[model samples]
Target chain A: MAQSSYGTENNNFGPGVAYSQLDAALLVYQEAGGRVSATEPTLDLSIHGADGRVLTGGLVADAVSGATPNGAVPSTVSQNFVTPLKARGSTASVTGASGGSTIIHLPPTPGQLATAALGRQYTVAPNTLPVDKGFRDHRGAITLGWSQPLGAISDVGFGGGFSRETDYQAISANAHIAQNLNSANTTVSLAVNSEFDSSSPFGGIPTPLTVMNAQWKTQASRNKSQLGFVLGVTQILSRRWLTQLNYSFDRQSGYQNDPYRVISVVDPSSGQPTSTLYESRPDNRQSQSVFWDNKLDLDPFVTDLALRYYKDSWGISSKTAELSERINFGTAFYLEPNARWYQQSAANFFHYYLVGGQPNPAFASSDTRLGSFTALTYGAKLGFALNGRSEVYVKGEYYQQTGNGHPADAIGQLRQQNLFAGTKAAMVFLGYSWDFH
Target chain B: MRRPLLIILMAGASISIAGCTAIGPKPWEKDLMARHEMLVDAYPLLIAADEHIYFSKEASSGGRGFAGGGCGCN
Candidate 1:
C-alpha cells in the first residue's frame, strides 16, 4: 500500500522515479553497446596563439527565471506550500507486477484521486526545482595557451584548462596547428580538444522515473566524455577585411539529463495530468556544425557577422545568426554591441508530457531545451587596454526564449494553459587577460 | 578519428597550395589582418563562458565548442 497527499492542495507529492530508473537502465545498455565523443564548431579553432603565454580568466554570474517546465503549475495551495522537498528526502516503494515484473508507483497530479481505488500505490516526484521557478549561479574558469614556432611558416599551440560551478566540473586539453602561405595572406589551421566532466547535483542523482515519495537508491554523481575536431581556413580578402570558414564535429557519451526535471503524465482524452514522471534522455549524442564569419575594419570601427548551421544525431537542428560592432573611443577604450538570433527544431522525443495510458516511449523529456524554440540575445561589452600586455573588460547580456507552447491536439484544460511559456535570463561577466614574455 | 584526421590532412594540403594560385592580399598588406580584432575568436575567455552558459540552458550543443559535460542546470 502507498500513501498519497493528493487529497490536500499542496501538490507536495512529486513525479515518479521509475521513468528515471528506466532511463538510467537504458543508458547503461547504450553504454554497453558503444560510446562516442562530440565536438563544437567555432572560428577560433585555427587561429595562431600569441607568441608568449597568455592567461585569461573570468567570473560570471547568471540569474534565470520564468522557466516553468511543461508549464505545469501546481494549485494555489501547493504554490504556497512553504515546505521545500529539499529539506527531506522522498520515499517510495516497488511491488511485483502481473507477470513477476516490477511495477513502481509514481506521484499524482494536484487534483488526482488517491490510487487506493485502483489497488495501486503512489510515490512522490523528485525535487527538480524550487516552487518559485528561479535560480542563480556563479561560475569561474581560466585557460593558458602558448604558441611555438614550428618552422619559418608554421606554429603549434597547446593549452588546457577547467571550468567550475557548484554542481558541475569540466577539464579539457586542446592543441592547434596553423600554417601560413600565399605570401602569408592565407592560413589553414586544425585543432582538436578532449574534455571530461563529473557532475554532482544537489539531492544526489535522481533515480529515473522512480517514485519520488518512495525510497529509491541514488548515485552521488555521473560522468561524461567529449572529443572534438575543427578544420578552418582564414583568408585576407583585402587590407581592411578578413573571412573565415570552419567545420567541426563532436561526440559525447555518458549521463545526459537534468537530474531534477520531470514530465507530467496526463489523461489521453482530457489532457489533464494524472501523475508526474521524471524525464529521461539518450546517453550518447554526435553533432556537427559549419560556420562562416567575416570581419570588416573601418579605422575606428569594426563589424563582425557570422552564421552557423548545426545538426545532431538526436534529430535536432539549428541555425544561428550573429552581428557585432566594435567602436573605438580613442586607442584606450572600446564599446562593442552584439546581437544573436537562434532557432532550433525539437528533439524527436520532446513532448510536453506523456499520455497516461499510452506505452511509454523509449526516450522522453519535458526539458524546454529539447523543444522547438527561438532565442534572442542582446549584449554589449566595454573593454579597456591597460597597456600592451594586459586588458580588462565587463560585459552583460539579456537573453529571451519563446516557442509554441500549446499543442493543437491538446486535451481539456491543457488547451487553456501555456505549455511553452517564455523564459528570460540575464548574465554579467568580469574578465581579465594578460600576456607574459 | 579517422575521418577528422583525413579532413585535416586534406584541408592542410589545399590551404598550403591555395595562396600559390589565388589572388589576394600580399604579405606586406596583412598588417591589419594580424590584429586581434581581425581574428575570428577575438575574446576566447568570454566566448568560452558564453558557450558554457548556453550549453547549460539549451537543448542543442556544438556550434562554438565541443560538448564538455552533462549539467543538472534544471
Candidate 2:
C-alpha cells in the first residue's frame, strides 16, 4: 500500500530497487472574452531511496498576457484612463499602438516648463468593460523537498520554494509529519507552512481609497506574511474503500490589497462614475476550513468524492463538492470524468461601486472575486499506460461562474447593466510520467 | 458560523465512531486499496495545479492541505 505521508505517495516498489520518477506537464488556460490567458510548463522529479527516503524537486514557468478588468463598471460614454509609464525617465517617444493603448507625455506639474513623466492611456468603448490591455507577466518558480521514515514514525519531511515574477516574489517553507496506527490501516498527519511575499508593482503602491491617477506614488513596495496548518486523517475503510479528512487554518497579515485594482465611485442617482479610487482590504485575515474525501474501488471502476466548507474573518463563506469516476479499460488505458460545484458568499465590504456622496468604508473592494457567486466545472481525463513504469495523460475542463447581475438596490443605469457578468474559462493539460531505476 | 461548526463537529464525531468500530480492512485484504486509483491523492500535481488556479480566481482556498505558497495574482 502507498504510504500516507506528505511527498511520499506512489513509493511502493519492489525491495532493493531504487527508482526515480519524472513528471512533465503543460497547462494552457484561457478566459472567455479576452480577459486573461496563461500558459504554464512544469517539471518534477522525485528520487526514492531503498531505505524509505525520498527527495523531490520541481520547476515551473508561466507566461500570462491579455486584457484584464480594471474593476470599473460599464459606462454609456467612452472613458479614458491613464497610468504611470513603465520606466521613470525614458525618452522613448510614444507609440500610436501600444497594446491597444497609447503613451503620452504628462504635462509638467505647475511652474515647470518640461514634462516630468510619461503616462499610458487606454480608452474603453461605450458600454464595454474597462480592461487594461497591457496586462502581461512571466513567472518562474522552484521547489525542493525531502522525506524519510524515522524509526517508528511513518514519515517526516521539510521543503522550501521560491517563485519570482516581474512585480512579485514569494518564498515559502513547510514541514510535515505522519504516523501510522491500527495495523497500518489509519494514518494521521500534520503539516505547517509559512510564506512571505513582496509586491513591487511597476508603478509603486497607491494609497488605499485614493483617486486613481497617472502620477506615481511614493510607496515603493509592500510585503505580506502568511502562516497556516493542516491536520489530516487517512483511513482504510475497507478492502476497496479509502477515506481522508482534513482541517486547515490560515492567518495572514500585512498588505492584502491588490495595488493595481480600483473601484468606481459613481453618482448616487445616475450611477455614473464620477471618479475612481484604489481598492482597499483589511491588513489581517483568518480563515478555517474542513475537507472530506473518499475513494471507492468498484471492480472495473473507481469513484472519488470530496466536499469542503470554508469560512473566513472577512465574512466570506464557501462550499465545494467534487466527484470523479474512473473507468478502466483492460490494463492500458483509463478515462476519468469529473465535475465540481462551488459557491461563495460576498465579503462584507464588497460593493459593485461606491456612491459619490456616501462615506467611504474602511475596507472596500469592487473585485468580483469578493462578490457572491457560484461556479461549475466539468472535465474529463484520458490516460494511456505506455508501460508498467510510464504513462501519458491529457485533460480538459470547462469552468463557468454565475451571480446576480442586477441587485435590487442598483441605481438608475446600473440596474440595466450586468454588474456581475461572471467569468467563463477553459483549461487543458497534457502530462507525461516516467519512472526509471 | 455556529451551524457550520456544529456540522463539522458532528461529522468528525461520526468518523471517529466509525473508526472505533474495527470495521477496517486487514493487511492481507489491502490489494484493492493498494491500487493507484484508490489512493487518497491519486493526482497530486494535477490537484496542485487546480488549486493554484482556484486560489487565483476565488475568495477561499485551502482545505485539503496546507497552502504552501503565496502569489500576488489576486
Candidate 3:
C-alpha cells in the first residue's frame, strides 16, 4: 500500500504555537534467499497553524527488484515456461541466464514464421521453485492532507494520494473526524477511505483458468475499486496509561486476480504437472477487523501492546499480537525493542496444484499469500535526540514466516517436496525529524 | 468469534465508564500525557512504512485505521 496521511484523528497539537515539521526516512528491505529486495525513500512535511489548522504533504519513491515466486509447484523434472515478450521488436536474442532463466525462441505457428519471435520462454531446473527473477519495478507516490478544528468537532481532516508504477496506478482519498469528551480524556473518531486502481500488465489480462500461453491477450487493462471505514476510540485509563480500540470494514470489487500468476495442473496419479492454467479469484471481497492497543508510561520506560483480529469473506481469518518496550537513557536517547506474532488461515480456494482430471473449481489460486501461515517479527529501534525537537533514529527488524509444508493428502512426488513458500526478511530504516518555525 | 467480540466490547465499555468517573489528573497534572512520546501515534511515518511493508506481504491488513491507497505488490 502507498503511504497515507490518514488516521491522524488523535493528532491534537494544542493551541498557541505554530511550527512546521519535516521528516525524512530511507528504508531497505531484503528477503532471504535473494527473493525480493526494495529500497524506499520518503519525505513528509506538516505545517501547524496557531489556531489548530494543519497542512501536510508527502512524497515517496520505491525501487524493487529480485525474484518472486510464479505460483507453480516444484517437480522432479525440469520445466519450461513461456510468456509474452516484454518488448515488441528488439533484436535482443535469447539471452542466457536472463534473470535466472535461459530464454529461448518458440517455433513458428502455421505460416507466421516471420513473427515467430513474439514470445519469450524460460527453463526452470528440476526440484526447484519457479520464480521470475526478471521482476523489477519502480514506483512513486504523493499525498496531501488538511485538518483543522471545526465548530463543534475537535478535528476534521481530508487527505488524498496518487501513486504510479510501471504497469499500475492508484488514486485514493479519505476523510476523518474526531471529537474529545470527558475533559479531553476520551476521544472518538471515524474515518472513511476510497481507492481506485488500474492494472495494465505488460502482457495484458489473461483469461482465467485458460491454458498458459505466450500469445498476447487482447484485454489491455482491468480496474478495481475499494471502500472502507474505521471507527475508533481512545481513552486515558489513568495518569500513566492510554488505550485505544478500532473497528474497520472494507469492501473491494473488480479485477482481483494476478495476471502473471499460474497454477499447475498435474496428472492425478503421477503428481507431475501436465499443464498450467491462469489463476482465478473471487471478484468481490468483504473484510472486517478489530484492533486494540495500549500504551503505559513507567517512569524511565514505556510499554506498548496491541492486538487484532481479522476475518474476510474469502474464508481467511487472522490474529495478531505485538508488544514493545522503550527504555530511556536520561534525555539524550532511547531504545525500543519490539516483537510481533501473527497467524492466519488459508483462503478457501487455495491449493498447491489442481488435478487435471477433476472438474475445475469456480475459483482457484496457488498464490502463497493465500495459504495458511504464521509469522514472527522481532526488532529494535535506537533514537538519539539532537535537540529538544530534533531526533535521528535507526530501526532494524527481522521477519520469518512458517507454514505447513507437508499436507496429509499430498500426491505422488509432491509428498517429498516442501510446498511451503513463506519467506524470511530483514529490514532497516533510518530517519531524521526536525521542527522549524 | 461472536462471543469473544461481545465480551471485549462489554469490558471496554465498563472500563471507559469507570475511568471517566473515577480518574482525574485534573488539567495541570497532564505533564506525562502531554509528552511527545506519549502520543498514540508518536512515530507516524515509521508506522506507515511498517504497515506498507506488511500490506504487501500479508493477506490481511487495516485494523487500527483506514488503510488508504492500493498497490499491486501482492
Candidate 4:
C-alpha cells in the first residue's frame, strides 16, 4: 500500500485564514474475465475543488488572559475518502466523504458546529485585521468504459462519467479508437470528448451576506459545455525507445466565466461607473494543442519529455515545454527531476485599470486588464515502488508569470515584483496504484 | 475537415471584402510565427464576454476570474 498528504494555509488581511488540502489514496486491481493480468488504472477523469477562505473580522483583545484572540465560533472539519475499481466489461467504483466534526477547541460557543458549516465570509473593510476561517469539503466522480477489438490491429472504446458536489453537477461522454501498424511497433489512436456542467450555490448566501454572494448568486444558474478531439500516434524504435505525438483540438462555447465574481470599482477620474453593474465579459474559446512525448529506457535510468503548443481567443495563446528524467537505483526506489516553460499573449481587450486614454467606442468594457503574460515553471517528482503492484508517486510544481511585449490593461499594477507571489498557485499530487492477483 | 475548411474559406472571403482584416505575417515573420506560442485567436471579444458571465455565476472562482475590484468581498 501507498499514502501521502499535502495542504496549505493562507492568511488574508480582511478574511480569515484559508486552507487548501488533499489526502492520499490506494487502488487495487484484480484480473478477471479473459485474462488474469496486472492492470494500471487511468487517473480519474473528473477532478473537483470546492474549498473557500473564511472572513472573520479580527482579534478580540482578551484583557484577562492577555491573548488577542478572535471571539469567533469554532470551525468544523470534514474529510472525504474515495476508492475506485476498474474492471474489464467497464470501469466500476465507489466513493464518498466524512464530515460533521467540530475541529476548533478555543473561542467556545453554544452552537459552534452549525456556525462553521459554511466557509468564511469577508466584509467591506480596508486594512482590516486577520482571523482563523479555513474550511474543507469533498466531492467524488466515477466512470464506466467498454472496449472491443476489431480483428488484431484495431480496437474501439466508449465511456461515460458523472460527478457531483453539494451545489454542482457534471456529466461526460467519451469515445476512442486505437490502431496498430509496423509489426505492432507503431500505434495510432483518436478520441472525442464532451462534457456538460450545471452549478448552483444551494442558497449559500445568508440574508446578511447578500452583498457577499451577489455575483455568486448569478453564476449559480448557468450552463457550461466542452468538446475536445485528440489524435495520437505512438512508435517504438527498437525495444528501448518509445515516442508519441498527440494533437488535440478543444472547442468550448458556453458560459466560461467564474459566475461568482464582479468588478465593483468606480472610474477614478469622475467617480462614475467604473463597473457596469454586473456587466462582465463572456467567452467562446477554441484551443488547438500539439504535444510530442518520448520515453527512453536506460536500464537503471528513464528519460521523458513532453511539449505542447496552445492558442486560444482572448488574445491568450501559449506554448508549454516540459522535461522529466528518472533514475531507479533499485527496487522500491526512484528519483526524478522535471522542468517546464510557458508563455502567453493577453486577451485582446485586456486593459489595466481605466487610464485617461481617449474613448474608443469599440472597446465597451471599462474594466481594462488582461494584456499579455509569460510564465516559467519548474518542479520535481520523487517516487518509490512498493512491494507487489502497489506503489506511491508524489509531485510538486511552481509557476511564475510576467509580462510579454504588451502588458494588458487588465493586469493593473501587478507588473511589479511585489504582487508576483499572488499570481502563482503551486500544486502537489500523490497517487497509488496496484493489482491483486 | 471538409466543413471546417469551407468555413475557413468563407471567413477569409468575408474578411477580405470588409477590408478590416489583419495583414497576416509575411514570410520573414515565420520565425516568430513558428515559435510554439505565437498564433492568432479569432474570437477574443466573445471569450471576454463569456468570462465575465461565468465570473458572475460560479461557486469556486479563480482563473482570469478576478474582476477589477481588488475587494472581491462582494
Q: Top DockQ: which candidate number?
A: 2
Model 3 spans > 4 angstroms off: A1-15, A88-97, A106-115, B1-24
For model 1 the TM-score comes to 0.71
Compared with the true structure, what per-residue lDDT tens digits does model 1 show for residues A53-138? Answer: 22222222333233234223222112111111221233334334231122343344333323311122212233222122322244
Docking class of predicted structure 1? acceptable
Give per-residue CA lDDT, model 3, range A132-156, as digits (tens): 7778899999999999999989999
Q: What Cα-based lDDT does every candidate model obtain?
A: 0.60, 0.85, 0.85, 0.39
Runs in model 2 deviating more than 4 A are A1-17, A89-91, A109-115, B1-14, B17-21
Badly placed stretches (over 4 Å) of model 1 are: A1-146, A164-166, A214-216, A384-392, A430-437, B1-20, B69-74
Better model by DockQ: candidate 1 vs candidate 3: 3
TM-score of each: 0.71, 0.94, 0.93, 0.54
- What digit string (tens of lDDT, one per residue) describes model 2 on residues A195-282? 9999998788989999887766667899999999988878887888888888888999988898888999999999888998999999
Candidate 2 CAPRI-style tier: medium
User: Cα deviation of A194 in candidate 4 (Å)?
Assistant: 0.9
RMSD of 2: 4.0
Model 3 C-alpha lDDT per residue in residues B10-56, reported as the tens digit of each score: 57756775677565466777777877788988888888888888888
Per-model root-mean-square deviation over C-alphas: 16.7, 4.0, 5.2, 19.8
Query: iRMS of every model, one decimal?
Result: 8.4, 1.8, 1.7, 16.2
DockQ of each: 0.33, 0.63, 0.57, 0.03
